[model samples]
Target: MDDIVKQALAKWPNVPHCTGWLLLDRRGNWRMRDEAAQAAGAPGEPIRHTALLGFINRNYEADDAGQWFFQNGPQRVYVELGYTPFVVRLAANDPSGQLTLTDQADAAFEPSAVYLDDEGGILFTNRSTPARVAVLHDHDLDLFSEHADLASDGRGGEFRWRDGAVLKLEPVRKSEVEKRFAFVASPAAYAATNPDNASR
Candidate 1:
């Protein structure tokens, strides 16, 4: 296993349950493993896409200061978990509304606002468009907004002010692209273990 993968796995064991857990190889080609495949009816493929690549792409970001961000697309989706061993529950619109619990570690990166719904999912504005709100169905926004210095706009849902400004809005559903991009583990895993190489 690559050192980064080892570190990420050690840091976030829940990774195995996320949409995908990919390793960036020394050459820059992405190596992905789909955890959903472990169960029945799960897609059978490894997520390989040069465009969908980044250390903080699908993985959480943590700085030495102990703050973290749950990256979604181009935005660093924040969650609020008071102290170490941050725990939160998540459930998506699909999948029968089953809730999945996640435990995060405290690590800082950039300061941003994160919102949570009663169901424990995350809510945020589009990175390119602040006016357009997005709800990450199966995520924990409360964990990222716990200590947020900013206050919500008094709407039932959490809010952030001018966090991610609006530019243009285009939405893509995960299920729509699941087959076009997702893949299963392969021998490529050997060469695509380093983030730099994974990009190639």
Candidate 2:
């Protein structure tokens, strides 16, 4: 959390949280959804301001309920996820040739486990207390395929990292990702069903 955001929370505690206004797309873009867009069920405009993006990334966090949000000074702006909470991509200029992964926030991610979804989506999970999951960027799939030894059934595989670490890839169904990872895909929809979790 940012110091300014912490001060704002201390100064004005209980500022109601807002949802259905921001989104994190599968491609790692932050989008701002307006009332019109929300009503039409459309993905909002992509947020391109560099400084604003940094601020949001700095304060992004998840609640005990597994709903991710950006601490916008005083109010919490919950993010609607298009996929997993984090979208990772291969880090640039990694001299070691090891396929380093960095989350959308541009932070280093060390996977404790990896999975291949039914649709060929690659998922990585870190060893954090609650565990954080990320989806590899689609553009990097070809590069990853070159390093993986997949099974005949395409259900399991072994990935050889440039650093000489071999990881066993497990199979997972796309529809079970949310429950398996303990994350809410749509916070607004979740709050609607669990009225007690909603902020008025």
Candidate 3:
């Protein structure tokens, strides 16, 4: 949390939170949704202001109710997720590369769990506290494969590499992603929020 935001919260502790005003799109872009855009049920205008984006990304946070939001000074601008809460990309083009995991809010995390979706989409989570599940950006999928030191064995959804099976991953349905990862794709999708039971 930023110091200015903390001061604002302390000064105006009763400010109501704002929702449906911001969005984190599937490709890792932050968007601002207006009333019409929010009602139309689609992504809003992409926020390209570098300073504003930096502030939002810096103050982003999630509540105990599984609601992700940006602490905009005194008020909370809740984010509407277009996909999972996170998006990861290959950090380097090494023979066996590492991942750069960032949530919709742009906070970095160390990937702790790596899996694939039914469509062969990569899914991962953080190693630290409050783990958030995320999908690897599609544009980086080929880049990941090229340098990840990975090879798909002659088996369905099976992967093998020099270090043996890094993970015995299987494909999972997109519909089950939220439940499997303990996150809300949209604000309205938030059901239960028991952090203890959230997939680590």
Better model by TM-score, 1 or 2? 2
Tell me the whole-model lDDT of each prediction, alpha carbons only.
0.32, 0.91, 0.70
lDDT of 1 by residue, 1-200 (tens): 23555565566655322222433221222334355642433324434554444344446543222323345433332322211112323323355542222222112112133443333344333232212222332334453344233324332333332233222222333333212222222213322463342212
Q: Clashing residue pairs, candidate 2? A: none
| C-alpha TM-scores of all predictions | 0.22, 0.96, 0.79
Alpha-carbon runs more than 4 Å astray in model 1 = 1-44, 49-115, 127-143, 148-200
lDDT of 3: 0.70
On TM-score, the leading prediction is 2
Model 2's TM-score against the true structure: 0.96
Mark the regions of model 2 whose C-alpha exceeds 4 Å error after superposition.
91-95
Kindly provide the TM-score of model 1 when superposed on the true structure, using C-alpha atoms.
0.22
> How many pairs of residues in model 2 come into backbone collision?
0
